[model samples]
Target chain A: MMVMTQENLTSKERFDKIFEVEFLPQIDALYTFAYHLTYNEDDANDLVQETYLKAYRFIEKYIEGTNAKAWLFKILKNAFINQYRKKSKAPTKVDYEEIINFHDEENDTNYSTHTDLREEMFQSMMGDEVTNAINALPVDFRVVILLCDIEGFTYEEISKIIDVPIGTVRSRLHRARNMLKGQLKTYAESLGFKDKRSKD
Target chain B: DYQELVRKVTMYLDNELSEAEAYLKVLSQEKSFREFIKSKLHRRKPSPALIKSIKDKIKT
Candidate 1:
C-alpha cells in the first residue's frame, strides 16, 4: 500500500497534526452517523475506526481545508453500504422508487417497526423515539435524511457523497421526510403533542 | 387549489422549485416536523470512553 507523500503534509509530525486538527473534531458527528447506519454501538465504533484508518492511509489525496466532515462521511457511508449489501438477503439494488411504490401500494403509514411510540412517549420524546424512526427507514431514504436534514449537507454535496445524481437525492429526501411525517404524526397524536403544539 | 397555488408561488419566489410540491404537501402534514427532526436528532455526544478510544486508535 504505497501512499503518495505530498510536499507540506509529508513529515510525520505534520501528518499527525493534520489528522488531529482536521479529523478529530468531527469524531462525535462521525460516530453519530455511524451509529445511525449500524444501529449498534460496537459496530458504530468499528465503522468510525475504519473511516479514520482509510482517511489517514490516504491523507495525501485529501485536499487541505475542504469539507472534511463530508469527506469522512462519504468514506463511512461507502463502508456501511458495502457491509449492508452483504447482510441483506434481498436483491443488490434497493431501488428507492421500488420501495416507495411498494409502501405506497400497501398504504403503509409506518415505515420502520419500532412503533412503541405512544402519546406519553412525546412527554419524554427528546430521545429514542426519533432515533427509532430514523433507524426504521430503508437505507436509501435514511441516508438522505441523515445527510441532508441531520448532517446539514446540501443536496449537491450529499449527491456527491452518496454517489447519486442530485435529482435522486431530491426525490429520496422528499420521500424519506414524508414517510417520517406519517410515522411521527402517529406518535404525536398519541402523545398529545398535536393538541399541545397547536395551542402553543 | 388556491392554498397550493399560494405555496407554489412562495416556493417559486424562494427559488426552491424542486421542493414546491413536497413543501406544500408537508405543510398539510406537520408544521414543526423539520424543527423536531433538526433539534432532537441534532447530534448525540459519543461516550467519553469512545472518544478516548478513537484518539488512541488514531494517535497510536
Candidate 2:
C-alpha cells in the first residue's frame, strides 16, 4: 500500500483518521449531490458507497491539508458520470463549447419575472417548490447550482469538482439561477405572491 | 452590465471579494437579492444504514 508522505499516521491509523474525520462527515453532502444527480435514493446511496470505497483504496493520494470535500466531490461526480455512461451505453453528452460560448442573458426570456419581487415573496416558497425547480433543470446547470448555491462551493472549487473552467461555472450558475427564478416565480404566484412587475 | 453584476454577486457570494467592495455594499442592501441568493433548496441526508454499510466496507 502507498503511504501519505506528509501525514503522521501509519497506514492503518491513517485509514481510520481519514474515515472518522475527512470522509464520514462528508457522507451527507456527498449523498445530497448524488441524490440530485440520480434523483433516486438507492442509486445515490450506491454512488456514495462506491465513492467511499474508491476513496479508501486511494487514500494515500489525498493530501492532508487539501480540500477533502472537493476531492470527494470530484470522485462522486466521476462515479455518477460513469454509471450514467454505462446505463446509457453512450458517453455523457456534454456540450462544453455551447456552455462556454453562451451568454448569460442571451436566453433569459424571463428577465423581468421576479427580479423586482421582495423577500416576502419567497417566504411562502416551500422547500418542495425549490427542490422541484432545481430538479427540473438540465444536469449541467443543475450541478453548478447545487454546488454553489446549496453546498456553497466556490466557483474555482466547483470548476475543479465538475472538470470545467471557472468561466463555465459562472455561466452555468447564472443560467441556472435565471431558470430557477422563473420557475420559483410561477410557484410563488400560484401561492398568491404577485409579480410586482405585473402591477407595473 | 447585468453580466458584470452577476460576476460580482457570484464572487461576493463565494467570498472571493472583500465585503467592502461597492457592488457588494449595494447587494447587501437588496433583501430580495439576498433571498434569491439564499437558495433554499432541500438537501437529502443518507440513511444511517447506508453509512454503516460503507463504514463496514471500509473497515474490512
Candidate 3:
C-alpha cells in the first residue's frame, strides 16, 4: 500500500485512496458496532452508510494512515446518539456518572465476592447467549464491553471513541462485566450449569 | 482489595496494564482467567450486499 501525502493528492484521489485503504477495511467492524447500537439490520446499514458519507464529507479532518477505525467508530457512535436515539424516542439515560461517583460502595460490595466467569460453562454453551447478554446491557455499558472485551480497543482509544474520560471507561467496563456475569450466571443456572464460585 | 484485583485482571486482559503489574501475575496463572480472556461474544458481519453498497456509495 502506497502512502500518499495529503498535499499531492487531488480531491478525487484523496477520497478514493482514503476510502479504499483506510475506511472500507473497517466496514464490517463499523457494521457490527452499528448493529449492536441499533439492533436492526436496516438501521445498522443506514448508520454505517451515514458514517461513511459523513467521513467522506469531512475527509480533510482525517489524518491519513492514522487510527481510522477509531475515527469511524466515533462518527458512528455520534450519529447513533444524534439521530437514531432521537428518531426512536429512546428514553434519556440517567446519569450513571453521578451515581457511580456517590455510590462507590455498591461497586465494591456487590462485586467483591463474585468469581470470574468460568470458561468451562461458556465453552459448552452455544448460540447467542453471549451476544444476547451483551445486548441486554444499557447502551453506555454495552459500548465499553464491546470496544474493550470484544473489539480489543485500548482504554485510551475507547475513551476517545466514546468521548468520555478514561476513568469512566474503566468504571463502566468493570460494572458492565459484573452485570454480564450476573446475567450469564442466571442463564447458566437455567441450563443446569452449577455456580463454582464457592469451590473456586 | 478484591475490587482492586478485579480491576487489575480486567486491565491485564485488555492489555492496558504491564505484564509485571502486581496482583495480575497471580490471577493470570489461573486457568479460568486464561480461558475467560479468550471467550468472546459473536459479532455480526456486514452482508456482502451491504459491503458493495458502501463501496458504490463512496465511488460515486
Candidate 4:
C-alpha cells in the first residue's frame, strides 16, 4: 500500500479523501489485468502505477457511482493497444503451430507416470496456447473474445467498452469461439488426443 | 450447407438462437454437430498460475 504524498497532492483534504476512498481497493485488480496483458511482472507493475497516476490526475472527469472496473480496464486496454503494442512488435506475430510443436518436442522426454503427466500438462498450459490462439485471430475477434470469454464481460458492457453494436459483439464472439475451437483441436491432436474435430 | 449448419448449431449452443431456429437446427443437423458443441462447452480452465498472474497484474 503506497501512500500518496501530500506534496504530490494538490490539496491535502482532497488527497486524503481520494486515498481513503478510490485508491485502495482497486489497485490490486488493476495491476493483475495489466500483468496479464503485458505478460511481465515488472511491466505490469509499471502499467498499474502509470494507470493510477493518470487516473488520479484526471479524477475529476470520472463519474462517481459508475462501474470502476470497466473504466479501469478501458484505460488499461487503451494504454496497452496505443502505447505498448505499438512500441513492441516482438509478441505480435507469433507462429502458434511452430511454438506448440517446439514446446511439445522439448517436453516429450519428461513424460513418466500417467497421473504425473496429466498434472504436468495441466501445470504447463499457463494459458499460453489459448492466448496465442486468441492473438492469432483478427483484431475484432480477439477483442470480443477477450472481453466476453476471458474477462467475462457481458455483450452490453462490451458494446459500451468497444463502442460496437451488440449484434457485432455477438458475431465477433461467435467467430472468435470458432477460431479458438480450431486452435484447441490442433493442440489436442498434438497432445495425443486423436480427435481433431471441432467440439462446437 | 455444412457451414450454415455449423453457424446455426453454434448459435444454438450459445443459446443465442430462437427456440424455433434451434429446433430446426437440432432436428435437421447431423449428430456430429451436437457432439461437437457438447465437447466444446466443456473447455478446460486456464492454469491456476495464469489466473493468479493476471489477478496479480491487475492488483498492481
Candidate 1 C-alpha lDDT tens digits along A1-200: 86756663356567688788988899888988988777677788888888888898888788878988989999999999888888786666787998888777566556334234544564554356777788889999998888766677777888889999977877777678667866787776666556232311
> What tens digits encode model 2's per-residue C-alpha lDDT throughout A1-200?
97546555466796688778977899889998898788778889899999999998898899876899999999998898788778789666777776764555456765346443534454554346766777789878988877876688988899999999988887887788778768888776676654453211
User: Model 3 off-target regions past 4 Å?
Assistant: A1-9, A88-127, A189-194, A198-200, B19-40
Looking at candidate 1, what is the lDDT of residue B47? 78
In the order shown, the candidates' DockQ scores are 0.27, 0.42, 0.39, 0.13
Q: Estimate how well candidate 2 is docked, as a DockQ score.
A: 0.42
Best by TM-score: 3
Worst 10-residue lDDT window for candidate 3 chain A reads A112-121
As for candidate 3, its clashing pairs are none
> Which has the better TM-score: candidate 1, or candidate 3?
3
True contacts kept of each: 0.47, 0.60, 0.56, 0.02
Candidate 2 achieves a global lDDT of 0.76
Itemize residue pairs with steric clashes in candidate 1.
Answer: A119-A190, A119-A191
Give the per-residue lDDT of model 1 (tens digit) for B1-60. Answer: 234443344334323577534544444334456667777665666778876876687666
Look at candidate 1 and tell me the lDDT of residue A46: 81
* TM per prediction: 0.68, 0.71, 0.72, 0.54
Using alpha carbons, what is the TM-score of model 4? Answer: 0.54
lDDT of each: 0.73, 0.76, 0.76, 0.59
